[model samples]
Target: MNPNDLVQFLKKDPKDFTKDDIIRFCEENKIEMVNFRYVAADGRLKTLNFVLSSKEYLDTILSDGERVDGSSLFPFIEAGSSDLYVIPRYSTAFMDPFAEVPTLDILCSFYDNTGKPLASSPEYILRQAAIAFKRETGMDYKCLGELEYYVISDVDEIYPGVDQKGYHESAPYCKFAEMRTQALLMVARAGGKIKYGHSEVGCFTKDGKYYEQHEIEFLPCDPILAVEQLIIAKWVLRMLGSQYGVEVSFAPKITVGKAGSGMHFHMLAEKNGRNVMVKDGKLSDTAKKMIAGILDIGDAITAFGNPIPTSYLRLVPHQEAPTYICWGDRNRSVVVRVPLGWTGSTDMAIEANFGLKRRVEKASKQTFEYRVADGAADVYETVASLIIGAMHGLSMPNALEMADKLYASGNIFDKEYASFLKKLRQLPTSCSESADVLLKNRKLFEKDGIFPPGVIDAQAKKLKAFKDAGLSDKLLGNEKEFAKLVQKYIHIG
Candidate 1:
């Protein structure tokens, strides 16, 4: 389909499109709806197919709402109070390319039986945070992410021999380039505006004989689009891998000793169409304060950012993982990096030259890159925490004072920097500690009742179980064979 035609179709009001129009669009596009399962119930997703046959039925369901038993969802509602509604946002509907019957994918917001938004709904939490930030800072926050993952063949799980190539190694060594190309096309078809896709630098091999396996990274324009692309890309990769008898894993650290996957988020703040982080070609005070705020709240946010127990296996010191809490310009060792050549003018910037004059025009268009998150996290919650934290920093009484205090103190994880970090009252190292932090800071997320007490308690219980099992010690032992062992298990599993 032509981009212009797609745009026109999207512009049409939902009421204007008939059931036939949707069906015809799917037929023309050769879309196939494959597997669909309810997130909150056991019913097959095929039920939606019948409902879509009648516009009236669809509208009634859309208006009256789609009900589901939320008890089955991870860490949400309990079985006793499981009734939840799925209110699909019309704007989020997109054709699922892999669907055999030309299916559509829509993001759902969970609500109680009474029609009130559920506090545990990750989407609701994110929206609440966004609204709060706008109210406080008068800025519109935009986030983009570079998501990286690997594609390999003849693998049940990720293993040492699965991928045997260096970064950007193509052709014989990176045989999965074709798969990535197809996946990129699927992402495009799903309405995700991709900035670019390419092979990244992290690759390794178990068997010395075959060195063609590789990983690919995609950069998406906005946070929402990035997350949608992440989900769609996963589906496409799985389907493509099955065709070739291969597999793909988005595990933060799929294989031990190799470079782990990270969902690196880049954030920018704007107001009234002007970038708030840039002033006179340099990082504005607001930008620095936002970075400082991230540094301040990173530990607590890690519960959502690095959600899984295996995630810590990748955050070891000096492995390009963010074990320390610090931010620096062009410093990969730190948690946040003010990407190189971010000068206010695109011409003067490292990537491109968009000439714009402002106070920070000579300074740089400051963007903060958070390297902490992994694939398993709920993107909505993680992004919400960042927005709220940044806003908190911006509105702090002594923003500059806090920024300088953090910068001068250096890595928060370091022994010397521990004192300063203590002064700031940061989060702890283990999952249990993180849970405690979350419990102590529940007020932060409860401002609008966006995060339910039950949800938090449930997650804390899971974290506690892992902690009690000493799983972290077993999985992260010594950090030397950690990567290799993980790869072996994941590959074999």
Candidate 2:
């Protein structure tokens, strides 16, 4: 059990949090403030603070929730009828590690005046998508995000590190290792099922600023919870960065030639609580359908996964980012990748030590990673699109054929496959192009009214406002211009 988790410490199941329990805990723990946090349309965490005055006030706030102007939070909402309610989700309650006033933070959901979940809310959309996916496919779609960001600090020449060689470095070389480890612990304590945290393959010194890339990956879970965990993880990392007098950026690109951060998501489908992504030492048909489904609407997903202008710059060739829509085993150049896992090996304890007698069998860790998304992505919307696209592919009559045709045996950009790569469809090259593709393929997400029409239009309009068509080519070979663009969006994630 996590010692920092209030729920676990109280010996209560995570799903069993109640208002009375929170009130009692606050009273016993002498908590002074209650923070109601939720995700706004800008994809940032918004907070509503309340100083606990009396038991009656605490009960009322926790039970009935509070109201806020929806128009101000969402661009699609009208001010004339903008009153919306923010109700707390009990399971998301946690102690604010950074709060000095003994505060408790709880994530909230949006509800309309009629007491219905707001259709345009990202949290609601993601929950509905998960429900719909399970109902239609008889399987639960589990997803985990690989969040990558660059931590920037003032350059110190004493222990200066080499450029592009920061992967898994140790103390005295990795400047921010201890701070990142602290963030990992904080996130895990706050209910994020984190897998691990590590330094990545991008380190640079430019203009007396030191930039080092790092990643925090999580374990697979339900789509809604998965996205929530990621959002919280981002918040914790940023909060720690601020306390440490450094800057953390989730932007897709920091330079024109260096390695860029990609928020890659690994996906798996489970049935009866067992992974169904692999079968008989090979990729299963179910997995193929999901891949085919995502590939079918691959361009449309960019509207949510890669929304900003600099996003296209990172999608360029030779950056370990995908330029073409394809899937391959362990291929980083493709949009979808079936990563290597311990699928056929087990009993390592006995093999490593003859003194050991027990043979252990490992659970399946099979999954396919979607490498198209970046840090600028709205976690909820991006996940919802993937689920909707997967459902569409599962229902498609020719999904397997589509997957078969797009499968690549090796690096897609190789000379032998140069002719074949030309025939493969390319992802959107600019923010405007992404908006156009999303508009063209809007029907896929709108089939079950899962994605609100207004939300789609709003996102498209937002992307089009960037007016960044051919922006990558225009900034190519111009390091000064690229640096300006990177600086503008350095803290955008």
Candidate 3:
């Protein structure tokens, strides 16, 4: 049994977890409830609980998962043929931190009536896309999500924080530090490879409602697990909010003029388990191909990356978000940004200590960040689309040329590069436009039959129903209506 782990399991890694091991651990730890959790069509976690009355009952529950109404969970499924099975993955086992009773929670994958992996399931789609990418390019597409959100609460004005000046702000001046720290610990304990957590730059008070933004970033891993980590982190954050008598929102925007939450994804290419995004202190060719692929398909993916009406509002100019489709090194105003990756830098420890020697060679930390995604994104579908886009770029003959032509120096929005910014493409400004682009470019995602046509049609139909062509303009100068709109979507994750 590991003392550091919340679950007293003998296995150090959850990948090595087995059914027998889970049974033994539950019996020994007096776990009363076993919860099977999975992501439904609406991009929220659903759970089916079981009570462990006896060993035989426990074995049966673990061996053969229970049936669920697929029609209720997924909009595409017909009620007549909605029966589906959910089988738990041993690697996702964790103890429910919010449960009053001892409970073991394991994330499940969906299966159809024929016991085949559900083709429309987001999990299955992402898995197939990854396998196809690896088979085609002999390299892996690793990604990490930068999940940002605001913790809304009703508090007194004793300790107030300034608006848009809360970057890395500490306690007394900044609130919700305890909530963020607990979320970070729970995420790490639940198999999320967390990088760090901190206060963000969008803190303010409006009508007795306080909004403080915070972000929890994860280390790079396989795309499938990366999305799972984000989903789990969101679940934990919401659970904590409920317990703390506050509100947690992953909404893209809470008001008209402030920083909005963006779920940016940093991606890197790896071949033979070695980073290939940088070599000789310069961007590698493989990395450029990935950037080109994202640029080519950025607009179309907005259907999954920015699904809500308010998502377009967040992409407006002067908010530090991207409006044009372009790529640049460490530029925040472009859709695709190559962040500072510690390239050509010496060891910091050696520089700080006079007598210390360099012990190991520097590893590449270069990543291509897709800045178009927001909190309303369908995590699984969005990542699957990005992976397919990368594969497309790798296969394209003129991918490198495309990347070179779209590169901008410094901020693309700067007056110096105004001419170049105009030449670049523009991202969709409304959900209607995104739906149109997605339908037009459907062939890009359907090339290898990874994304089902039905799925694409459903998303397009949903986005078109919003009818928010000029929602931002209409809401301008109407603070009452804007506040109502923000409250309506203040809990979207």
Candidate with maximal lDDT: 2
Q: Write the per-residue lDDT of candidate 2 for residues 264-375, one digit (tens) a residue.
A: 9999999999899989877899999999999999999999999999999999888789999999999999999999866766566668998688654456899999999999
> By the lDDT metric, which is better: model 2 or model 3?
2
lDDT per residue, candidate 3, 243-310, as tens digits?
A: 99998999999887889999999999899888999978899998999889989989998999999888
Q: Clashing pairs in model 3?
A: none
lDDT of each: 0.61, 0.90, 0.89
Superposition error at 319 for model 2 (Å): 0.8
List the candidates ranked by lDDT, beginning with the highest: 2, 3, 1
Q: Which candidate do you rate higher for lDDT, 1 or 3?
A: 3
For candidate 1, lDDT tens digit of each residue in 285-403?
98888887777778877767766666666676656777666676666667777775446434434335455444543423457788787665557677887887787788777877777
Which portions of model 3 miss their true places by more than 4 Å?
Answer: 1-8
